[model samples]
Target: MRRFFLFAGLLALLSGVVNAQDEFVTDSVLLHEVATYAPYKKYQAGAKMESIPASQVEIAQSAGLDQLLSRFAPIYLKSNAGGLSSIRIRGTAADHTSVNFGGININSLTLGQTDFSSVPVYLFDSFDLQYGSSSAVNGSGSIGGAAYLGLNGNWTDGARVKATASEGSFGEQLYGAKVFLGNGKFESVTRLYYFMLKNDFPFTRTSDGKEFDQENAMIENMGLIQELNYRFSSKEWWKTAVWIEHDWHQVQALMSSHPNVPSETLDNKHIRIWSEYENRRHALQYKGGLGFVHDMQVYDNNGEQKIGTDRLIAEIEAKQDVHSSFGYKIGAKYKYIKPDVYAYSSDVIDHEQSAAFYLSSFYTPLKTLKLTVNLRQELVTNFDVPFTPSLGAEYRLLITDLSVLKLTGNLAKSYRIPTFNDRFWPELGNPDLKPEKGMSYELGLQYQYCSAAIQTDVKLNGFYMDVEDWIEWRPGSIGWEPENRSRVISQGVELQSNTDVFLRKMSFNFRLNYSFNPTEIKEDQITSLVGKQLIYVPKHVATVYLIAKHGLWSAFADASFTGERLADHSGSAKFPNGTVLDSYFLMNCGLSRDLKIKEQDFKLSLAVNNLLDNDYQNQPDYAMWGRSFRFTLSTDLNFNKNK
Candidate 1:
């Protein structure tokens, strides 16, 4: 096959380079090196502020991401209870982007967001977010961006164990444990996390829709990530690695009782699995996996009447992705979707599948300029094929040893086919629909200055994107049928800055970001959304953090703020006029101290979220947990740093 030959040629080329340099060729491969390196010191501080993994970008210096992230006005966040929500890149709508776990195509699922609350940072080797029109490597219907989560490899050295506990404001309690075992060839890791949110959360509003009594909610998550690698005794170039992961989650629902009615109780669960295999450069990497989700909702209709609703989903996926040092990277993947909803006794199931292939060029002719052109074609089980293309370029200008001028741009065509729930679910199914398609563009500039005494960086970026067939759901005249007759147009801008100062034993970092969006609807029936600020899309969001480090001691302070915005499609009138959730700022403060236990070095940290006990609402009808505190202690033991 063409792929086999391409990979084989690249392997041969790489082997010769490794033999000469005694290195893995990572330095010669920018992208691969970015994935393997720990990142520059300047970037490390910015990652903590943005909560985005460092592997997502390559820069020798740092900039203010907090300020830039705030400009896009993301709806949900890692700090929010609903779940981890990322900013819409290039002003694209949420539906335009594709979401992925490992290599699984999660873009076709019911929910657009993934919960990152339970994934222990230590277990992840790296996380990367590709902005604007993901390539075929991720499958189709991805117009906005793609986020990849990678687990650590080469865990076959020895055995390791760690445990931690923390308690914080709002009756918050946290506990976690992890175990790692390896025999120089096989590896396994198990992690468990438990978080409890009690009634101690404060509420500033009153019973008349004002600040009422504080509410409470709780959640539990358990996950296991295992990887096994086999190295050929004779063929060191040929190796196979297998990965498996499972995650389970449960949560307590929030109560909405600003008036007199008691808060309703809710519970839900989810199970997911991911697996993949890689062959170094010997051939191509093969990956495939599946996911199953069960969601149940129960509530009292009118105090005496009880109602229940359930949703079950099954998703299967398979793909073959290849990376080469020759001229390009290529991949193909397929996904099958089946979802059914049950209310009382009636039920409906919807089925669909998606197949796609992508190609990315890797050869760059210029020393400072790198360009990549990608194309993908996808076919839905019952729809026409859509061809998407993306182009990206990065230029690094060496201004001086301590500073560099970096410029980057991305252009892509995107599309999102209707989901099963969007087209076939009872009371919400719309079969007569067209897949939404779009185009996006972005350009950014960065400057960095890193030295022994001080480190500082500043970045500026401007981007815009538009979409058509922006699918919006329309309720069918019948109690349980649905139609799609809505579309939308969105545009926005972003600006950000970051800086830091390094001292004898302390470091200070600062960041700022801002965004602006004006959107509208095209249909008359959905006119209610016209000229109204997009729901959950804040105009401005910002975060600031300060960190200090001393002999065996580290301390930090962080604060985040979101501007007031519309709550739903109705905007004002019918949706409760002027129901604007007041804007409030939340702060977190923590301190970590190093300790020596036997031959191991342990670090203990105590932190409090919402240190000021500020009352806030993540949603108009739902309030967020009040001040919470946690204590975490961890230590690492390693027998080898370089192999």
Candidate 2:
């Protein structure tokens, strides 16, 4: 406790020294920077798209990407004791959700899933979540949704630099810095971040009722990002970026029963470089990129395994505006993927190549009505992918100075190809597996109200999806093999609301989001598993956050609730009538004070997560963390020689 008190006292002293020039500043520096971007424009006419601003992203920088999503977004994160985390969107499998960074797909070609826990939140300036099927625009493997992380190259007025340092529970430390430099014709932004953690939290085993401390759990991560932009002419510009990340972590045992297992480790490295050129005068754009990823796992019991993947992508697009009421986009892309795995005393290599052509048309015949149509066709090397298409429409029902209401609907077809592991993994692979196909439908209503003192927004959406040829691994006469044996159906409802009120000297913001999703296996080859809920899928999830700010001090509280979910596919003798995980509720609170030291700005914040100390697990035998605390200090510096 001495350390806490010492830090608190130091902050108080600094606050007092900086408060002499008391000038009320309502907005944050991060928010001010985000405002420089062009106002967000909807890419999809009727899709459910949510963009998280830079200010909010900064609030959760120390917690990684998975924690940020679970606290604020409607998606679900399946965590293994804070080790590796995967995302599930709208009751879909982890592999069904596509992750993209700056127009490049970052999902692994071998495993087909991206680990959200390994990604740092500080690398990207913007986060966008697109709900429902987006295969028409994002290509295959987007059966549920798509997530996009982008870096904005729009520089500030002059040159600026920002730095942050944070410490948290379980011996976690983070340090990062960002630099921005620009004039009129040239601009550049560079970032460097490093984080380390020792995850040795204590937990109690549910089955045996015994207490134990986690062991052999540690993580070290480092990343760097560089972006540059050049404006050759008023209508022509070139942009390029490079990103590299490296991670090394020790793998812990699965359960308390195996605490004395041998040492295990996982290492990963990734590198990507991309460039794009756009000429608005000619209505043309061209982009291309190359990425490389290497992964290695060392285990005493299973020997060493290494996997490498390389991706090459190129695309050219054209846009035309025929009239004031209509516009269209046409694009063609080609992608080549090669994966090599070294396991089982041999080397396995495979190739996947595809070419896709897409066309999208938008029409605003009337001021109150808008329509969009999109179609895509892909030709794969060894698989026959069906034609995918989507249609969406939006109409304004009522409009006035105080309130507005809008209705939107969409229908789309999507598909996911089998991964390399599913097709050729020694004795466990099945080369006859077929791709999973899905059809989805959605309808939504949105209402917005604005006034001098208050602002409110509400949205409600309902969706349904049917999938065929769902892949599953089952025991065969010889051994376990992957097969296409199940037909799945999923339906859900989403509701969201946000309200902001401004008083004489204070402001309050409230946000609430809820999702009700139930996924089931409608038809299956196994009799015992038919008509059962899918594993690790929750029926209901909800989140709420309240913020209050007055002058330089601000406070906020967040609450999240997850409903009960099944643990396994079928019941067994050990787990009577099938294992089910109970529902859990978590609460978090934070307080921060902003100070102005001359021209620079400083902020100190203290946060407590899992306030109630809830004991729960998203995956069986993997206990979650207890109550934890985090402290962060950040500052921004501006340089202007003329000033």
Candidate 3:
């Protein structure tokens, strides 16, 4: 009780650190930046894409990307005690979803996936999720979905700085700082963050109902993003950004272990550099970019295993207006990858060079109807990848001042190339593997209504996808070797709603999302596995979130539910007839208050996760952290405003 009063007193005292000023400004100027060669434009449309609200992202600023997405997105995240988290979209495998950095696919060349735990939610200015298969725009490896991440330039002709400090249960500490500076022509965005967790939380054993503190689960992560934007004229500009991060973690033993013995550690480092130039005009608009990604990781089980990859990419694209109702884009891209690993056939430098061409056209004969056609072709050395083509159309059903309804549909073909580990892992690797090809169909209906009293949006979507020559690892004569084995089928339905209600002095926003996904193997050598749902894939997921805002107070709550998942066959009592994991529901909530500390803006927030503190496990033997509380304080100062 005394500590609470002292904390309140300190907050009150800090609220008067500066003199009052009337020129407190809050807004940034959105600057034009060159595009990074994409075949399908978002506005012209191909898939169901949604952007995360900036206001809602504030609560997860210090948390990882998995935490943020788990609160809103309907996809399942196989989070291993908050340690190795990966995304599985609509029952698709983690590797099937492409994680792109500024329009460039940056999934590991060795593992063919990205660790969601390695990404900080505060690094990017904008985050978007694209539903269904989008290989026509996102390139290879997007068999299920894609996430586009980038930083936007907000040159507001002023200097602003914000510092954040947070502390949570179980020895959680977070510190971050952000700076934004603009001089009309030159703009800079700098972000730095450091977070650590001594994950020594208590957990109960599922076997005998005993308890023990989790051990060997410490994590320390830090990152930096430095972006600079320069404008040459009203229609031309350049952008350069550098991102660096390091994550060091100690692997935790399973909760079922009494004297836990897993003492492995993971060390990961990432460095990314990108630069782009865009010339925008009436009809002839073109963009060009050069980027590089450097990733290295070391894992220790009994001995240290090291792997690293370096990738360089170059792309250019131009768009023009052919007629009043027709437009088209042409682009070409090239990527080179080099990998260093100890499990390879040889230590010799092995480099892969690939080139691709992208073309798309947009036509709108009437104001209420529009169509787009996209095609992409790629060439690799000594291998063949199927050419991809897609078509999308949108038609407005009703348009008025109070409401609008639209119908959307898309058909696309996609493919995924074999990863380096699948093709080069000593004798077990299969150099004769083939690319996985897939075809997908989508249909959606969207309705929106807006007025002074309320605003609402509802969307219903369905997708069916089939993949051929799916790669699988099997026991061969030499060992486990990769092979093009099974044909899989995935289908799902999604329902979403976004609503805003305005009262006299208060406003409320509600968001709901739900999906029913079923993925099964169609053809496989193992007959029993055929027609069975993929292990670790869930069939149902949903999330509901609410945000409320008043004069100086705001609050948010998120509730998420995941249905039963198919567990791997163990032939035990627990899995006598292919039994599975049980469903789980989780909730997170936060409350925040905004304050004016003289000339600066201040915010204080309190967040709680797993409010119910349910004793549950995502899978067998892996226990959750139960519940945790976090308190954060942020201060921002702006200078040279009204420029």
lDDT (C-alpha, whole model) for all candidates: 0.48, 0.75, 0.79
Model 3 residue 61 distance off true place after TM-score fit, in angstroms: 1.4
Runs of candidate 1 with Cα error greater than 4 angstroms are: 1-97, 106-108, 115-125, 135-137, 207-216, 231-268, 282-326, 343-350, 474-476, 479-486, 522-528, 569-579, 637-643
Query: Estimated TM-score per prediction?
Result: 0.76, 0.90, 0.92
lDDT for predicted candidate 2 compared with the true structure: 0.75
Give residue 434's error in model 1 in angstroms: 1.1
- Please give the TM-score that candidate 3 achieves against the real structure: 0.92
Which lDDT value does model 2 have at 123?
Answer: 78
Between the candidate structures 2 and 3, which one is better when assessed by lDDT? Answer: 3
Error of 2 at 617 (Å): 1.1
Judged by whole-model lDDT over C-alpha atoms, candidate 3 comes out at 0.79
Which candidate number would show the highest lDDT if scored against the true structure? Answer: 3
Q: Can you write out model 3's per-residue Cα lDDT over 336-423, one digit (the tens) per residue?
A: 8878686764543378888999888888888777788889999886679899998988788877766667788989898999888888
- The clash count for each model shown is 21, 0, 0
Better of 2 and 3 by TM-score: 3
Better of 1 and 3 by TM-score: 3
Q: Which 10 consecutive residues of model 3 have the lowest summed lDDT?
A: 17-26
Clashes (candidate 2): 0
RMSD of each: 10.4, 7.5, 8.0
